[model samples]
Target: MDITIEDKFHASCFTLKKEDILKFDKEDNGPINNVLIGIEHHCYGVRFFDDRHGLSVEMFYINGKGLLKGDIIQLQVRDPQYYQLLLRFCVLLADDYKEVNALIAFNTFQNKLRGFLEKRGIFTVTSLELRQFKGQSAVMVSPSPRGIVKIDFINQKEFYVDFFNKIANKPIEKGKEHVYLMVNNDTGLIKIGRSNNPVYRERTLHSKEPSVHRIAMWCCEQNIEKKLHIIFKDKRIRGEWFRLSLADLIEIEKFMDSV
Candidate 1:
């Protein structure tokens, strides 16, 4: 239950036990690695770019067994942002167990995970591609905004139901522009205005729309509402959509204030 990679080109080696392998698998339960073991026998080796650092080809292995001695497998690694993108892509592109298993397997065989990503409007980065930039750091820049957000009335409704269910400490309803920090199903952060375009802003949260900062984006995406509550704006926040519940509106207002 261990996977090892002999970095033939770089002359480095990596090893991990089954538990560690499983941990990575839990992070992404795709067959790209798992199938490498059950079929190809050894985790396939990939040479990838860590965009966080300038372009260097690093070696990674998918764990299994049976890779032919001296056989070479090419691979790529993108920044952590790409990792989140892949998670969502895998779910969207492969909705069932079989489709998921197949595509994950195919992605390994094609050795073009980078190219595949780029075609989908997701720019792939290499250390070399990054090194060309000025004053680069390991920090990630968000992707361009999609301008579309899937507001979960269910979650919003539940928030209101739970809020009014309380005997005391009832949230006050007010006529003001209230903004809240909301997270999409993708765990992307957004500043939802009681009136502005929450969906559109959510899309740009990654790329350019600039209302919320990095910390606020991180907080909401992590589903930690309590920490977000203290940042409520005591002032009137305005936007176009104003019929939202008091609790939900206030929660959003607090988050906006915090930001």
Candidate 2:
């Protein structure tokens, strides 16, 4: 588990790829491994995955502008000592789940472990697993009766803002808005599209053509829970509409199937 740690002042020193870029695409799921230069410095790395297209990773803090370079960059994994300690701690807590004193031990260890995972890009699960539990506590660490709890992204600051905006339906404005959205409560294919005039089109058009309903239907037929949420996207530009590709839909279905 010993992993190398790379340190440099600029991103030119690191490699970037479609796999890495997808991994860091903040639009789908907040990238995993918000790697920082040091304990206090900003994150230089993030990870993304697309089962259909493959993985994409990115370095968000490359010399400040956040540009992707073609050079190959190595990700630092957790050290053997750290991982062993974590696995042992998890085993202990799992064994003591019913004990009253377990709460104290669990909280202490869980916090420490979470920080450890975030630091080294080694969580109890992958970004997919983390996203499955986006707002609630980790089921692996902290069991829940519902079994379907939102992931706890308190540490992932980006998650909260998008969650809030979706709940509020606050005007996303007319621009190039990047959104990773899902539909759960509604029992049909949920359409995902962007409208240059969202106010007129989304509000007025209800024909269901080119809608996400088809995607939702496929998920439903497969017995997938339709829990939809939006991930963030860049909106610097405006007045263009985009819809999820059929291939992307297939990827979504696969992600749903795994969960």
Candidate 3:
């Protein structure tokens, strides 16, 4: 059996109704995918679902971040290659679920897959997956275990640029630093920071058990994150976290997009 790992997730916008944006107006909250990880999850991990030989495929989804929250990371194991399977699932969703409420169906499928993987000693990440009480009294948490691994931004430099360029549908100057926005959906608190490893920072926040939904990440070398922090200091909740309205989000969006 031949297998390949996609180095990066395709960072693209998902379509949703205006009603959705209003409902989820907690500042650029994810924008929705087919059968998403959670109600406000930003990162959507999509890949194959095999029946012949169940391979080890894992991605971190902590509540409103990747998958769902809790000890179990609920997600859909979809094989888009199999149109029949997708069609069957869609039909089932429409027939069984109310108004094709895909969350129930997709969650079921993902949970079932997780069960299968568990039985086979394969693991994807949930909130509690990386946590462990070691030895006497220390609690050690790994943000990206092998199961829910982090993207290597340094090594795969070109891929990063290419992915962003594709998202913009225009060429971007390869940047030396990245400024990102992460939101805590539960509290409606947003974090604006600069980090080379934004994903790692996100998972670290996940360890604290906030619904961290990654809003957007932009590559820039300047101290823009700092500048934004100072600009929005009045709106600051604490530290890097700011209480931003949708309009403020748009302003920040304009700034990031400019870079």
- Cα lDDT listed for each candidate: 0.35, 0.32, 0.46
Residues 1-259 of candidate 2: C-alpha lDDT, one tens digit per residue: 6333222212223444646544554543322223212222122233333242222232232211233322222222232233333333323332322221212332333343344444444434434356657788644643432222111212211222242333314444445332233321122122344333433454344345323211122112212222322320221122222223223344554664565
- Give the TM-score comparing model 3 with the true structure, all chains together: 0.34
TM-score of each: 0.22, 0.22, 0.34
Clashing pairs in 3: 61-67, 63-68
Model 3 worst lDDT window (10 residues): 149-158
State the local distance difference test value for candidate 2: 0.32
lDDT of 1: 0.35
Q: Which is the winner by TM-score between candidate 2 and candidate 3?
A: 3
Q: Point out the higher-scoring one by lDDT: 1 or 3.
A: 3
Please give the range of 10 consecutive residues that has the lowest summed lDDT in model 1.
Answer: 146-155
lDDT of 3 by residue, 46-160 (tens): 2234454434332222223332221112123433322233333433333332222222233434454455555544445432333344244754444433243211111122222
Q: Where does model 3 exceed 4 Å of error?
A: 1-175
lDDT score, candidate 3, position 164: 38
Task: List residue ranges in candidate 1 displaced over 4 A.
Answer: 1-11, 32-53, 56-59, 63-110, 116-259
